[model samples]
Target: MSGPSQEVVAPKAPQRIVILGATSAIAEAAARLWAANGARIILAGRNEARLNKIAADLKARGASEAIDWPLDFVTADAGAELGKMVDRLGGLDLLLLAYGISGDQGELERNPAAAAKVIATNFSSAAAWSLAAAAVLEKQRRGTLLVIGSVAGDRGRRSNFIYGATKGGLAHLVEGIAHKLAPLGARAVIIKPGFVETPMTAGMANNGPLWAKPDAIAPIIVRAGEKGGPVVYAPTFWRGIMLIVRNLPAAVFDRLNI
Candidate 1:
């Protein structure tokens, strides 16, 4: 008698991914994970040299193909530029928006120019790229638009309310995008990470139980890109922490130094 019939499983297609602000620590870490899975990646950022270096490293780490494109997110015409990128890539699987700036809180408070720059980088530019990616995903009727948000957005704090406001605004924006994509079989996710030890937060006093490394946060990002809810908190505990922070009585909140 012959053996029982065997089943043949087809190989999965490699992911085509684009990472805006590809030089950021957390973004780079997430790209590494995707690369190991044989993803074809395009890195967009202002630093041509750094992007090239990261691309080479990704290729070395097992990416099917990795390339770099230098882009200045603040001044670019996001919709037009993103259309060009999508065309070049032939298709899209995920678009990760990871660029941001954290101006000194004291300087931002006193310097209108500095504050404006922060708002432009963190909110206005980020939103534009997000919407552009959402359009691409909608048209394809698949894929995910994953944006890097921060736990700082959960509530206004005396220390970094300006930055917090940008993130908070971004959270709401992504919520709407998520709703729009759901029926179309697409997805948009906002990743809210707590204190991550990246170059952006290098100057801050970071020793604490709450702080997390980019490598530790990267896996959550990779999973979310594949399949995720509208809003996710990396390290998971931040969700509870933010819940407590968001609901605290204003009278008591006002007295505490955050």
Candidate 2:
């Protein structure tokens, strides 16, 4: 009776995701979006109470499963902890490194210890975790490692050069990892967002049009994980903005107060 047979396609399977620095506003927002897709997620952070609360919220939001793993990002043995998490999850589809600190530029300039802490948290610790996750993804020959970077990293400015430097370093690191994973069918993505309205930036003057909410940036992060990336600028406009800044002459750039 039928003239021709139609092909039937199966629905895509749910993703397995891990969010380090799960308590951060941006990470939480992204996790929420993933949860709605029936993803299985793990929330890893130093604050157990907050992680538990977030895990419960994600579950309520329709995540297939949500597990909280308390972890101190700075001092933890990244390789060992990541291996354990991979085992617990049975495998990994995506790992998001979202932990970072934007220390007071003035304080960082004055106190070496303060600057050190910022460097350690934003660059050293983040890089360690990234490498661990990269290794896992490489071994599996699949998955994505997504890291949150900042637009400030596009060019070093007087206002937040320390933080900017760390982000710039992270961008380069992710680029290398991306290259390494390319042959293996794995991916590493770095998301650079500008002036996000998160708890971290609450104290800063962020009411301007350029400032964006964490929720607004979360979708871009999720898309990058699902698709592919080495570098992504949230809102997409920042790429143009940064291109201009990065190409500015040193003499002209030094005169302006950014």
Candidate 3:
């Protein structure tokens, strides 16, 4: 029998973390930036060899332990497979779902199937996999879900409506998830970056005010996670700029053609 004077013991902290899109440039940078002193990691992605390499690299660079779980996002059961992997990892301190596919707007306009696939990967697939994370975080009542979004989602663009629409849906998804998850002690952070140079956008011009490389943007994400914030802009300066951008009249905004 328990008495009022008796004290209960708290569980130990979780050491394992899983990054669903392990091979991505920003995700790997995140792994490096947030390794802590000697954390354990479970890298999961489409390429088993790449995941293995990432795991080995993490272990070499201050991570106490690291392992790879092969996961293919193109497969039909990506969500279920990732959920099982997270469960097997025992407990996750952070779960990052950062899958993105660049869509060719010109081709997408001609082919409905192409646009549909891109949307599925960018929005539907991400949502499905994140549901897996949400379930685990809620059960644990203590974990973080970080999703990398883009400022392109803030407004539709003539050059890439297909891609912008996908990101728009993602923006909405992150907002909804953050509100629902906050009270449970589990939380989500939506990272809206303004033009980072990655393999994804090397061909694009880099003249924007806060344009930066993935390396520069990564530290911002790590800081946000450490500080426990729900939304973060990669350069931090974009917060004020976006506030003004969002408030401009649609007629003026359209004529300005940003």
Candidate 4:
């Protein structure tokens, strides 16, 4: 009989990693860390200049290979493009989806087009890319899929519910996909970060103990992809914070401002 001390080991560092939102602060932090560890990275995003700069930095930081591809996820053919990337890399060991816009909540409420853009960027495009990537990983029967979500997704708050709704939708989709992929030896991880100091939140008053820097959260995201559970909260305390929010009774929750 096997001993109680037996433990399953995590897979090796992924050789080829596809970062969908390569220019995002958190993603770029993760890319640099992975590059330093010798991962081959394909940085895909809309900003060609930013992509090139980050790719060069990754190479300088010791990435085995660093390349970039220009992509506007809202209009691009996700399935075809991801297929080409996987083929170009020979095989994919990890795929990170870290792009999203924190659409103005008040503006979204007043503008239908603004709301649609948020939905497209946060949910529709991500779903499309996830399906495309899932197909490839399923066939290969290996790889890790890491998605950056938000704690707001745990429940709807009036402050950012528009953005929260999109993230909530994504978390639900990936949860179902995780089960489906498990049987095939593939893993899907959802990283729910609290208040991070990124460009997306630059306009907001992000100072104080609650806000985290990109570099602080980056390692947690990478480790979750490398070896961890399906859902993770960067900095970890956010998990407890959200648990309280989620379990609040409807009447009590509605009376207070979050």
> What is the overall TM-score of model 3 with all chains considered together?
0.87
For residues 1-258, write the lDDT of model 4, one tens digit per residue. 966896778668888999999999999999999999899999999999999999999999999999999999989999899989998899999999999998778999999999999999999999999888888889999998999999989999989999999999999888777888999999888899999999999998987899999999999988888788688998899999999999999999999787
Q: C-alpha displacement of 220 in model 4, angstroms?
A: 0.5
Tell how far residue 225 is off in model 1, in angstroms. 0.7
Q: Pick the candidate with the highest TM-score.
A: 4
lDDT of 3 by residue, 110-169 (tens): 999999899888888888777777777888887877888877787776778788888878
Counted clashes in each candidate structure: 0, 0, 0, 0
Model 4: CA > 4 A from native:
1-10
Task: Assess every candidate by TM-score.
Answer: 0.94, 0.94, 0.87, 0.96
- The local lDDT score (0 to 100) that residue 169 gets in candidate 2 is 97
lDDT of 3: 0.77
- TM-score, structure 1 vs. true: 0.94
For all candidates in order, the CA lDDT equals: 0.92, 0.92, 0.77, 0.92
| Candidate 4 weakest ten by summed lDDT | 2-11
- Which regions of candidate 2 fall more than 4 Å away from where they truly are? 1-14
Tens-digit lDDT track for model 2 on 94-188? 99999999988999999999999999999999999999999999999999999999998888999999999999999999999999999998899
RMSD vs true structure, all candidates: 3.8, 3.3, 4.7, 1.8
- Scored by Cα lDDT, where does model 2 land? 0.92
Residue pairs with colliding backbones in model 1 are none
Give the distance in Å from residue 217's predicted Cα in candidate 4 to where it truly belongs. Answer: 0.8
